[model samples]
Target: MTGPLAGIRIVELAGIGPAPFACMMLADHGAEVIRIERPGAKKGGPGGDPTKDILQRSRKTIAVDLKSAAGIGVVHNLVASADGFVEGFRPGVTERLGLGPETLLKVTPRLVYGRMTGWGQEGPYAQAAGHDINYIALAGALHAFGRAGDKPTPPINMVGDFGGGAMMLAFGMVSALLHARTTGQGQVIDCAMTDGTALLMSMIWSFQGQGLWRDERGVNLLDSGAHFYDTYVCADGTYVSIGAIEPQFYAVLREKSGLSAEPAFDRQMDPRGWPELKEKLSAVFATRTRDEWCAILEHTDACFAPVLSMAEAPAHPHNVARGTFVELGGVVQPMPAPRYSVTPTVAPRMANEQSDTEALLDGLGYAPDEIAALKAAGAVA
Candidate 1:
């Protein structure tokens, strides 16, 4: 944990969904994130293996049964020593758990409290149970995907879960942390996945208002509307993506593919002619294997690329050159993102599960007898 946020300490109340995802991002960026997991919590939730969870990488874990007053006291103690805290419970759940903002903020006056939810802290659906698809469905993101004539396609929870959910929580927490540092004040960040997803759809909303986009799915400029801006299946059953948006880039694509003599694409921006041009381009692209098209246009600014699978992305030249992925604990996964120039980050140490529990408690100023009692009661794992 040695990056731009080298010294920031975060206390995370472990739960599911966006909470762990948010804390993971924080831990990745060099924050000292200490996760408080449930006593009997299991591994392999949404993110990954609890032991090998890349998202939970680089964080210290303390298991506590919140049903006990001592467990809640442990969280407050951690908060007193931390700069911030993040939780993903429903609106009143934290208050019921005796760790609400009002109580914790009194203990750690300068703490930034980040709260993540699907419907938000107070709303009609605030207490309802829903997943990423349900949240983004109301936000118009899901409605904008899929083929033109087909129903909307769910993008596998990435938009709402990771983008709107985890990413938004991270952004809000950082903002609150900055404010806390400067104003000597702490505030609660109410990060709602629904709101975040809706915010992400603003650009498409603008395009729709201007008549540049259609309400129908997959017919907008970036949503497979234009032939050059969509994925095309190659002769080898694999697919490649193209994005020759600008006229110059489109010209490069034509010249490289030996289609400059074709008149179908003479007028690029005419919506009336887009259908015919797309048909012609599709035909031309489908003739070659994905690799052949990559050889012709991948390196150029024709804005073309092969639609690499999950396994292929880490091996590509660009990803390899950028060191975009790292292998740890016999697993190859994406590296922590948003690299810093001055403070470099590293992968977390994988000691035995909860191996440092007693030592960590000892270091945190907990008395030896109290720690032994916690273990004796099976409240701490």
Candidate 2:
């Protein structure tokens, strides 16, 4: 608790994916986040090893069986102490659990209640089961991916889950918390992945509206439709990315790549010539190893970068120098971003299961016997 949000406390009803990621972001920046997991849920869920669940890092965890009244009571007590609360259940799930925003906001008038969902709280698809891909598909983000005449590509879960869902929830929570501090009133934030994903595509939609972008995928300038703004495979089967969108940078790419003399490259802005130019650039890039290309263009304004794999990214010279990654709890993971010069972040810690229950309860002023009775009643594990 050393970053900008050090004094804030959040109670997270631990679920999966986006919610965990949002809580992690808050915890990473020095908020005291307490994750409430189900008593009998599997350890780490799909994150494999609990310690290596990067999304669950930087927070304390308490295992509570919300089905039990005593467990619900425990959450109510935590809410009384917390400045904010986050849950990612389907629209009505929290209401059934007796932990809905209406109930919790009454306990803590200044609490910021955050709800993360794929389709939002009142949409027709709100109760429908879906994943990140489905959320982005509905948001019109999925259709923007992939080349012409190819099936739409899902950009893993980043666009929908993290960018749209979690990040938006975090921002909403913080903003709501600021308002709560001034007015002593709590509010619910309905963060839908679909809504956030569509927001992320605002610039693209603007391009389409202004007639600067085409509806087809892979035919747009930023969507790998242009020769200068796409990934190219190297001779060694590795890859590199280029984003020479400007004429100056494109000229530099032409000179460094020895394609300056090629007459076809002169018509860089001609839509009809893009496919042919892309073919020739592909052939040229395939002649060099990825590292060799990096050596020639990486430091220049060619808008170039070698497509480093996950294993290779942390070891890159620039990343290492910037301390972009750090080793914590014997695992290498990304550090808290958007560094603050006045109030720097503390190192992230691994999630501990039920290890903080007693201490957390004690901090809430529960007697030892009371906590023991809570455990005995199967309210907390």
Question: TM-score of model 1 relative to the true fold?
Answer: 0.96
What overall lDDT, based on C-alpha atoms, would model 1 receive against the true structure?
Answer: 0.83
lDDT (Cα atoms) of all candidates against the true structure:
0.83, 0.92
Candidate No. with top TM-score? 2
In model 1, how large is the Cα lDDT of residue 339?
A: 77
Query: lDDT score of model 2?
Result: 0.92
Per residue, candidate 2 scores C-alpha lDDT tens digits across 281-327 of 99999999998998899899999998988899999999999999988
Q: How many backbone clashes does candidate 2 have?
A: 0
Clashing pairs in 1: none
Q: In candidate 2, residue 192 scores what lDDT?
A: 98
- The TM-score values for the models, in the order shown, are 0.96, 0.98
Cα deviation of 41 in candidate 2 (Å)? 1.6
Candidate 1 per-residue lDDT, tens place, 1-381, comes to: 477777899998877768888888888888988888887677446644665666676778888878888788878888888999999888988899999999999999999999989989987899999999999998888888798788888999789988998899999888888888899899888989999999899888898889888788766678887877888888899998888989999899889878899887787777677777778887888899988888888789788889999899999999999999878887777887877788876565442365356776898787999899988987677
Best by lDDT: 2
